[model samples]
Target: MLPALLRRLPRRHRASFFRRRMGAPGDLRRFLAIIMMIGCVFLLYMFWAQPTSPTSVPLQTFVPVVTSKDSNTHYAKIDFRWTWTCENKRCVRKESTETGVHVSLTTCSMLCGSSMLWPQPTGPTTLGSHSVSFDREQLTFETTATEPARSYIQYSFAMFNSNVANLIQLQKNEPSATPQRDFNKFIVKVFVEHSDIVKLTLSTDESYKLILRMEGENMIGTVTANNFFGARHGLETLSQLIWWDEFASGAGSLKIVKGASVQDAPKFAYRGLMIDTARNFLPVESLKRVLVGMAANKLNVFHWHVSDSQSFPLVLPSVPQLAKYGSYSPDMVYTASEVKDLVEYARLRGIRVVIEVDVPAHVGNGWTWGPAEGLGELVMCVNVQPWSLYCGEPPCGQINPDNPHVYDVLEKIYRDIIELTGESEIFHIGGDEVNLECWQQFRNRTNPYVDLFDVWGNFTVEALKRVTKANGGKRPKHVMIWSSNLTKRPYLTKFLNKTEVLIQAWGGSDWTETPELVSSGYNVIISHVDAWYLDCGYGRWRENGGAACDPYRPWQTVYMHRPWNGDPVYRKSVLGAEACLWTEQADHVSLDTRLWPRAAAFAERVWSDVGTKSIYKQEQLSIEDVYARIQMQRERMIKRGLKNEALWPQWCSQNPGMCL
Candidate 1:
């Protein structure tokens, strides 16, 4: 009786009865109600927080350069005006167009229809009716539409603009009260074909017209510029647009897929190639042909090795004799207009032209002065009796930096180079291979070891700064030197701060053996010869009885070689990589034969992920097949009336990689 009574009371005394009741259906209903409330909150937050995809709405842009009533539009010029709105209000914005009109010039301003350019009438001028305008970030062409003989017109950005930066900012911004921040998608539409007259229908499916669409909530672009074009036209055109439809379908010798679009951008910020013209004196057209190949692979920077131990092609405005005496031809030097044309061509392709005037060491025969204590025929002593005349003999001249006049000559030459190249920053003044032995031999009896080497290097730096400052400021300029100078690190450190310079580590044989120079706190560009040097012939050549040292590098080797062997050197400083074409076995014809197909491989390696392990992932092309494609493109260059096109190998039965 007591136990029964205790059990009945315990259920009441311990509160077990209430707790047990709570664990039943009634409690489960309450737990499910709480869970449903949490789920609702989560779904609501997701609905408000998630980003939207880029808008699918069609956005078309066109910059019509000409609309002539005469029905003959061969030479007719029309300025382009184009624009698009962002569906992703969060994206930043930037853009450029080509209308063959220099809006900056004072002579041709009539078409502005706004304050973008001052009004002017000159040189195949456009009348009032064909005016263009940019209003509220929208580009409008106010010309009457007509039947154009040519169905397509195209243009590209002439210079780098802040539009891309703006687009980025816009994309990153959250929805706010601001007009630009109210959206989620970014859409850019470009028109590939159009009639001279406005049509009722502007769909992409039209026979004579097409639209390229790109949409992104957040977008980034990688741009490349070559020193040869210095204009960055290929990138600009890719950034903008170019149409070859004026030529017949086959006449243009190019093809595009219908309704095909790509969200394309560069993998690396700088994709570059260097050509040593000093050794083999190539024609200007040769440079253009090389640029054409570079553009195909999206290579941007063109490092022009204009001067070396062999010669100097630039005609300094201050000192005209260099062009007359130093160049391959009297009129063969790059004229101001010719430079502009090259710049324009490269600008169309989005390439940056970087000019290299190798100095102090490889100024060639004309710049050799100073003492000669067995400093070889090319090197001149820096100290004793440094002031000398060009005797029309070997070892003719060396600019004595201490003599003020020599420094002046150097300054003038560099300034002229800047002005001729239109003062694009990032200049290369070669300060390599100075023979201290010669300086010691040519010692002034009065001041033994007058510290001239240090003084000369210091003066060169000052001279470079002067030219760079004269053009713009420090931000626009970069001074690049070979890693061989790392051996002279003490000299470099003593003369100039390391921050002001870029070191190109190109000690092919010695560099790969060690990584000390890169780890030593210097911004280094890797061009390791054993791996990256395109000039080294491939393995098959040696198999076929070629010189053992002179192995040919097929495109595969270039595609596979890594810039760094997982060294800690990258953590300290590393700018990027460059592919060099030494002219020892190169001219115009052999240049493409050797450089092309291989250069394409280098471009891919440098631009793609450095950690990418597989070379087989790329287009599975044999060395012979690669050359065949290059030949086809080379033929296209020839049809464009380029003289250097003749330099490409016309026939090669044997595989370029295999001697057999």
Candidate 2:
């Protein structure tokens, strides 16, 4: 009892007691030093000797193998051989023939095992630094996990239901050489006695140092997903979805808020948000992060504007030179496989990607190709010097829509695009701004220069449709054109009368100022440019003039804009909203700042049941809350190497997103 009290006493007081008892100064000093050293060693030993975990569960990346009685394989025999340095610690393994097989290895230094046909085998697998072997019909795996044991015995049930061909294919496509980089590291060990219905005793542990053991009738051992990083968050997000097949949590069984049956689907069948890679190209990794953000917001459509007048991003198989002339870099084109990878990644997150090759007007090839050059008959020389800007010479460039050969060129390009993007039902024939001046200058040489509508705009619609439909595939379902067409009257009637085209009503929607196109029985996407455009960087009131004053929109403006203002009955025309970032003068430096935090609001507006308000008034609400969230998001963007810092200004107006 006296020793225990002394041990419990404060160390300084104990030392004082020692000093007082020792009397001699030098002897007391030496004795105190020795006592202090001994105390430290004892503490360190106490920590080190506190029983290292007895079991080691190694992560193994396993391929599914199937065999049936019809194949005359004798119960698929398995042989396992394991070699480990036990280091004087007892290494023991328990195995069984019943309930398939169970094996557990116990040792202080290392626990290692090799076994055959264990644990209801048809299930998912995890990969790590493990070695597995199979010969004749015998199988073996040899590995040792850490002392605290952080690994899993992922049971594979699909093996029983697979054919020989599937087995062969699975074997061929084994988990990556490094499984830790692929599947997350996890472990579970369970001990049961006698009856399957009753759990007499159970034990569980994790790398996070969480451990539990119990004896009960019904038992469940679950590891809450770590809010860690990388593929783990992806796994966690997927686990929360309704359709996740593997490890899907049953209703009320998992830690979910009760009374909340979130039977929700996306509002629009197609929620499209475009990134203009043509004007200001972004690297693949940058685009991938954007894709992840898109997934988070439930925005399904990735309208990748891969090409335009500025440059092309697709590597044309038929016309490789086109990419050379159009791309920013010598080889700046997305390979076929890369496009497939993007598609598959998007598909996993319930997103569909649509590629847009804005043709005829936007692809100003004539500017670079020059006149007298045979570029789909689109370039024309104003004078003797064919390529000159003006030489008493002809201004020789601009696509001549009247030419028959022009249609043939487009047809070839369309075929190539189709092959690259798989099969998209809608093709955006960008008929936005053909500036009549381009046609008026080179008019007589191309077509019968008739009325304002018929000569330039009307002709291209029919010609483009003809060429697009000529391909063997199904005719594209829809074509997207700017709302500028409605302002251009009889020409609008020409295309509107022919096919069902969706008009993107993006001129700026106002409660008082009604749009002629929206009222004219047209299915309109209410993408008002003032509110939703993300490309217009912050600090634009000074740089680009006040009328073009596009200070980066904060959260409130995005969330509160009402789609249907006038009448609820007529609101079906309000298909959905799209947040576009037109890269007129955008780069990686300022893109993420303007688009994010601001875009997060638009996402909430579209996905959540957040109520609405007048666009002007919405800017007045306290957006500071959203700004805090934005700061967090901005930090993430920066960490991911996004150019978000360029968006921050040295000083900003207190009421941002408000019109002065």
Candidate 3:
């Protein structure tokens, strides 16, 4: 009907008719006039009679837009802008600025509180407003009876430090002044709902959930965990999310990007790192630092290679003479108290201490333990004897299998170690590289009563039984051994129970032994030497003229390692992987450089998805993008007192994407 009426009337007449009928002119000019009048009323109401509705406006637009002072300037400037929303109609904006701020608890508290604007309700119909402020560095908020309180929770920086001291201790190298400020303080808000005894159990779901929303003045963040261990991990991740910007405000500040959320747990139960302290004695303090590094990466197992042919640095109370004779020096041995301290420290970081006593084959140093103990001639000297009489390797050794006293000594050693490192369910009985010559001598001594293979099989079986029997009754939850036993001597399986042992597959990359061990129903931890060994490339330890292992194992190689790439059925038997650092030439000076960044790569490989895209990949991220992230983490570690090797030139690290 309207179309017919418009068609019957002229264009000029149609406008007048519609205006008369609708009580307003339908022309664009008249319509615009009405809108202008409404806008004027709104502007007047917003400028004069501000409503009680509360709103927030970023301070960037306010005058005197107090820019952040240069970081090195020792003074802080804060600018705040707040909006008062009135009845969903008008909003009043207010600004405040504080310059030349000093660093003090009282000052910080005042600055935090002063950002808020208290709104006053003008009329009886207006809603009640809030008057919020902070005192004593604590945020205090109060709302009127008509308004529901919106709590502005302010957590003490000291409280945050205490909550994550285990992690903070990693940052011991950080400057003493405002150390917490090294990382963004607002990235994570940790809340513990219940105070339960936090024991580091082997539960995969030691529940933790983190949520981050990047769409505000401050990125709102929350971390919820069932236990303290999970909370520690969440905080580490929050730290990882933070990026330090040197130019952000002159000196430097940590910044967290807008949106991210991660609910993480170890996919495999035994993400680990093996540090060989026996080959070249590492200081107790250095080992503790390594544990801190491992915790930072969320790697839980510290596979301590405590003893080897080169040295027996672990001081056992039952066999005190071992350290006296076997250790490189008196100062190098780990005392009982120190061992306990290290174990406790690891436990607090959710790391389990697994001691590796590489036996029989690597027991050349055991001969020095003492002749009275009958360990003096445990194995023939590899270098001093006829090749056929000792072992395959140049430096060969083995505990005399024919001696009954050997088993007795083994039991004592195992019992003492188990007692000292409390709650260790897995003990590594190093059964790798037991040359045929050593067993042949045992066969010759026994005179056909037992063959060479039989001697080796018997020794391994007896060692497992002794270690297990010492730990209460049943076999230890797991006994880790090198892959050579399962691969080279398949006959040993006749006397072995697959469930009681964990095969550490450190066979060089070319060796295809991991799958067979896994298929045979033994759980495995892949430490594939060619790929994950950090001690490689420096040179083989005992080789003449320092034989080099060629190219060093870079972080990329460690990151590319996939422990369960073959035989899906056997994948379940694959417990996890570890990066083994044999400290043949390493000492305190080179320890951090040898392990870090590269070890960190292994940590990410074990913690994150196998197929996570790499920055170096084509059409993906630029090299600098990934390099910067890793470098940043490395710098954080260095600040925490870890001496890390530089990944690239300083210019490349400082300028992201510029290296490419």
What TM-score goes with each of the models?
Answer: 0.53, 0.54, 0.68
Residue lDDT tens for model 3, 432-452: 877766565443363756556
Best by TM-score: 3
**Which candidate ranks first by lDDT, i.e. highest?**
3
What's the residue-level lDDT of 536 in candidate 1? 73
Cα lDDT tens digits for candidate 2, 185-292: 112222211111110000111011111112242111222322111111122222221110111111001111111111122333445677888777777666776776
Give Cα distance to truth, residue 447, candidate 1, Å: 3.1
In candidate 2, which residue ranges exceed 4 Å CA deviation? 1-260, 365-376, 379-398, 446-449, 467-473, 486-488, 511-514, 537-549, 612-660
Candidate 2: C-alpha lDDT: 0.44
| lDDT to native, each model | 0.47, 0.44, 0.61
